[model samples]
Target: MVAPFPASFLLGLPVRGSRGERGRRPARCGPLRPPPGAQGSCSQRCGDQSGPCSCHPTCFGLASCCADIRDFCLEISPYSGSMMGGKDFVVQNLNWPNPTDSVICSFKDSIQTRGHVDASGRVHCVSPLLYESGRIPFTLSMDNGRSFPRSGTWLSVHPSKVSDSEKSQLVNETHWQYYGTPGTQGNLTLTWNTSALPSDAVTIELWGYEETGEASRGPSAAGVKPPTPAGSLEMGERRFQYDSGQQCCYTADGTQLLTADSTGGSTPDRGHDWGSPPYRVPPRVPGLSHWIYDVISFYHCCLWAPECFRYMNRRPSSDCRSYRPPRLASAFGDPHFVTFDGTNFTFNGRGEYVLLDAALTDLRVQVRTQTRTGSEGSQDRGTGLTAVAIQEANSDVVEVRLGEGAGVLQVLLNQEVLSFAEQSWMDLKGMFLSVAAGDRVSVMLTSEAGLEISLQGPFLSVAVLLPEKFLTHTRGLLGTLNNNPADDFTLRSGEVLPPSASSRELFQFGADCKGPPAGGEGGTALGRARWRPAAVFPGAVQNASSLLTYDSKFLAWGWWPWLGSATGSYAAGRATHMWNPGTWYPSFSSRVPCSVTEDPNPEL
Candidate 1:
């Protein structure tokens, strides 16, 4: 790129002082004093028709000499720097009247630091670290603490080492740190597994939406504008953005999940315990959390792990990314179940049911089921699933729901709807989370702690896949993962029921397991073998709304399917629906705008 200044700056031309002082170069433009009091208005001296400014660049704002005086009068070498600032911005012309006099450099108005006037009349100022990357304006102050103007010159600060569309140039090199663009760097240590990395040369494509870009759509040559985001998922104080079509790859932290009282929201819920199932201890591997990929929404990054690290546009094939788990369990059909121990059973009751709950580590799954309805009306043939909520340890509550439209599905991270622009898959959490639109909408967490949930549209039949570690360690309607089929009907009591238990017995067993529990939330009686809800997300309440479909006052509890607004079952399941709390202040009351059920046509 060409420099914005003329070639005379490089040669350090002897600048004029006033109209007649042509060859005279002032050491430094001292304070206005009595002689050269601030002169010249920017309106007349700052435009294209203007000529050289005799005063110093430091005198621009104070004197209002020339608007472009900083850029025009000062010559700074290497004008750009990294956002993690430390480099010096040397402005030529350190010539000061008194050798002991000091010069100060000011940035962004508030950031004023000392500028060392070097031997060559060069003002050496160190830049400060900036949270964002962009053009920063700064100014030079000649007097120690006397007076300095607000605005300064511009310095370009960049976040990434490689410029746009430039090669990373990291060849065959391993054991090195890598960072994506400013907004694209996600939790790489947790989601991406080196074992799943390609053995051959890898082609990585890093793409991210600029935080500054508006989600606007304009017509093309044919005057056709593409579709916008699918929907906006609104929790009490946070929102997640999505697109019209579900494309794949990458992940990003949503806007800070702030509560009403807090200034910045905490993202602690995304932290997971990868070690044990909390039911049965799996032999801990050193680095197991890095499953398939750890990406966010903005960056459509496919860091396909091959040999060399280079940027490319070609997409990775499905055949190359297939994963075969060592052990798996499923729940589908009229919502029949398969335990981690591979036990199969059919529970016809509705309300809410626990698919899996690991208490100690905090990984759990709960599905909301309502009475089955055919095209005619509510059918007497049992119940169907409505919503499935997956709590990744303490992190985001990802609730996959059946949309009002037949083939359409909606995903809510925390309480906000996930708007998938064009990507087919997104890693909502540390897990290699992905969603596929096909015969059914499925959310598959392909990390080492495997899990997959699919919901059939129209009918809303759900199918869930459990990892092997869940064996004998989990509790819920799906039953303990232990291989004993008879124990599948085990209640919180040590009483083991026979396989031929009556319909009434099965219903009670489901109730025992689908617990907000007996003792204060999930703390149940001894030997009560059931799944209970944990207060994973803040703002969980037992108000009638249950936050399912209530778009009203969104108070505490961001978890799905419910919390103890008053208590029904499970720590926070569908104790029913949340009562609208719009009338009351969220912080003071559990009021809601509307039932936050992601379901478009929820009954409640």
Candidate 2:
């Protein structure tokens, strides 16, 4: 039973007051996994802290609990919950203001959620959705699951099926599935029953993401059911026209496929881009990504759904495909961000900032930004990514930096600089690094580290692909990955930055995560000695254009650049702002400016 997507991608309204006080979080804590040899020798038992660390429900906040504390020490409230996963699942004993250790909830072993200490000081993540019924194996990981202890606790997924009435909302939900393993591109299969005919030169319009991993990226969330996640890639949409008897429709750009095959099943690179070529799908970003799945459909998508399926109601029994692909979280541009939980927002702060800090694994990422003074002499108003530094538990600090101009870049591993004098590839540890065509550095940290970092040319635009472990093991500017956006701005200090924070506040907030001073928890990397100034335009004059705020309705994140006009930064404006004029059939206005921001017209 899938729950509805958050309002973010919908009406483009503000989420400020929409979440209520329940969203408020107490200070956060780092992860507290058991010591290295603790899990290997320690037997399974509560109150057995004598073996290593103290084991108690209260000890969790202090990072002194046993690995299986959640098994016997801590407890969860409401043992039973709906299969849909929106209900709050709380840890009863672990008090709030947990400063040193974090709590992780494991649903069976497939899904993990980061639990937060609420205003009441209890740890929790909204309940989870389980396709199966009855007592499911549920456990806790005080150390981010280094030892899940499958022998521990349970959560009952209510067996009751959602009544058709209860599922009415799902009828209007967006249903886009990702293609699976061993396939690059595939065919777009539109299956319909024979009873209804394509009698009137019917045309099929297919809308699904082209690139691999993650969804609702780049484009405005307007007309989309769920608002687009923050920091998504900038991508365009593709359109195809099909009259009767046309074997195939030409793809807009001819690179990506909608699905691997008609039935939407995974196979070994069989069907790649079935009908035609791909269009408007951006390349995959590294570090800032993951692999979760969800569904959302806005007014534009909803209005057209009925027409597309008017005569094709039957889903073939053979089409029963089970697809649970990994989801991605990324940050790029100047730069927009899609949090681990799909929260989208733009951070234009300058200086070195921590992208995310992973617990257990000790993987830390810090990025540097440089700003350009606009024609208005707005010093440091326009910012661009300059470098990205990645450090894993045992790995060297890998820094990929932009060169002097648009076509050069430098790669440094710890203090040893890697010379790619020209376009070349070098294998480091278990990962591969290459200065590819177009002044870009691609760091594929797969197999050994679940990360892929892509730093573009000309001062660079960066993207990272996150691992599934990131869900409950990370924090920083990218926010918590618990599939809950309400706390997306949660700072490492455990403070949740409010949506109403001014530009200066936003700048300062990001600066704080540069990671505690050297010798502190997460020390800075090479070439990063002093933290960048909190203010980008230090002595520059400031006004409304630079201190923009989020809209009232859908919280479409409206951002005012440091020195430029705030014009289209408000995401809500996309609701009425017409998309590419050439993409729409039966075109209305070539481009319709939003009539009003407060109350947007669903019909463009």
Candidate 3:
């Protein structure tokens, strides 16, 4: 008599949403063993479209129907990552539209103005019409922009275009509007004239939240209540102290506006120092980049507790440890170093490069050189194959793509590959391959593909083992990536991530920290270190899935528990590393000092 787990699988994983809706899409997870290319012979989409049986879209965006092979260890299942079964797991609040003030008419209208809200709230506004080439499609005005209530219309996948194609596809909710299309670049296109309309109504929303669960079947009947998914505490590094009372803006050569000194240097640019005089001497565009608030501040991370990976019985916490080994990270500019080209190498110029070969075989490449060919084939295919660069020149460069392949596989900056193919392999087996640090590197292999390819020494190895809570030399909390915001795991401002780079849901984010959780201003004293592959907790204890995904964009999955045959031999399930963090947590207070919290103010 045990079957009841769906309260949305105890309200946890599954929270997808990226905005920009055409079809909206978001829910997907089908084929587990049926789609490899349609497997076996012919099913012809079941409807039999002649005799080809095609279903691939990743078998429905990537199989995993959960048929059973013991569910692949369900990843050490406690509940087996269950977002209920119905799946939706809600949370959305878009609202949008923040233009701020009023007037802005230019397109020879003569630079009209009157839109302000700057003091930090940010709302600059302006619209004079500058279409030098093509792009300016602003549509939203209860009257303001002068007359624009066309209300959604831009759906043209096919109809041949001349006009009516189903319409409704406009985008540009706010930011004044200007993206290239009417005369290009200086874009300013509009011809509305209905006398505008009723004052204002530029809403434009997209919110999120859709949790629906009902399929747990056990452990107390009502279902789903194994939640201890909150924080995996322990964080450091914040350094930024400097305030002598305020009012500081250096640039006479000492450089200091947003502060960050050690002599790193950078500043100037806000109207070229506007009217100049608050300190003097401005006006230099040599390479122009000015505007340095002196950045780089993160080191706060947490939220990843799908039971924290259970270990039970005893003997495990040295900090978690077990797989990843071979360190030296911190290079790519300001910290870069991971090179080795003994047998093949070549990349004259351009940009973007990253190579970390633990060596396997067959992966050689090449580009732009027969003596630097770039003067004929239309400059050798426009500036010598600026698009790709190989396969008889012109442009095509290296590509072996896949995350699910077919499209999205790019390369350049001296392109070349010839290790006898079979896919050179760089799917990230062990770890490390981050780009953007000088970009423009090279390598080669073309003697019959260098004999099929084989070179295990220059270092590029990866076995991919990261599940013991991160196995540590210490320096806790490392989970975050929610919507990314362009930081993408380099976290430093408030840092917190003990074991969760991104389990993928596009990249979830939800987990707050303020100390032990009491009414909310807590700060300091957090004891929650977790890593349950079955259960293990020996020192410190609140790494509840890195604080529930960084404070509740919520997504701390890992719940597999359905093994009931007594001892037929597949049981191994039990991981409960909980820490909820705030609906309760005071058990007497005492010694609690793991402070540091403030990332959008825990969402206010």
What's the CA error at residue 266 for candidate 2, in Å?
10
Query: Candidate 3, after superposition: displacement of residue 97 in Å?
Result: 22
Among these predictions, the greatest TM-score belongs to: 1
Worst 10 residues of 1 by lDDT: 278-287
Lowest lDDT sum, 10 consecutive residues, model 3, at 293-302
Candidate ordering by TM-score (highest first): 1, 2, 3
Per-model lDDT: 0.41, 0.41, 0.20
- lDDT per residue for candidate 1 within 327-362, as digits (tens), equals 556666666776555666776655555666655446
Candidate 3 lDDT, 1-604, residue by residue in tens: 0111222222222222121213221122232453233323321131111111222221212231122211111111010111112111111111113333232212223323233323332222222212111112222222245642221111101111111211222233221122322332443222221222222432222222111122121211111121122322111112221111113455678645342332222222222211111111111110110111111010001112222122111112122134343222211111112212111111222111111111122121211111113235232211111111111112122322111122222332111212212122211111112222112212222111111111112111111111222222112111121222232222223343233333231111222222334422123111232111111111112333111011111111111111111222222111121222221111112222221111222211
Q: How good is model 3 by TM-score?
A: 0.17
lDDT of 2: 0.41
Candidate 3: global Cα-lDDT?
Answer: 0.20
- Candidate 2 wrongly placed segments (more than 4 Å): 1-324, 373-379, 421-423, 446-458, 513-604
Off by over 4 Å in 3: 1-142, 145-402, 406-533, 537-604
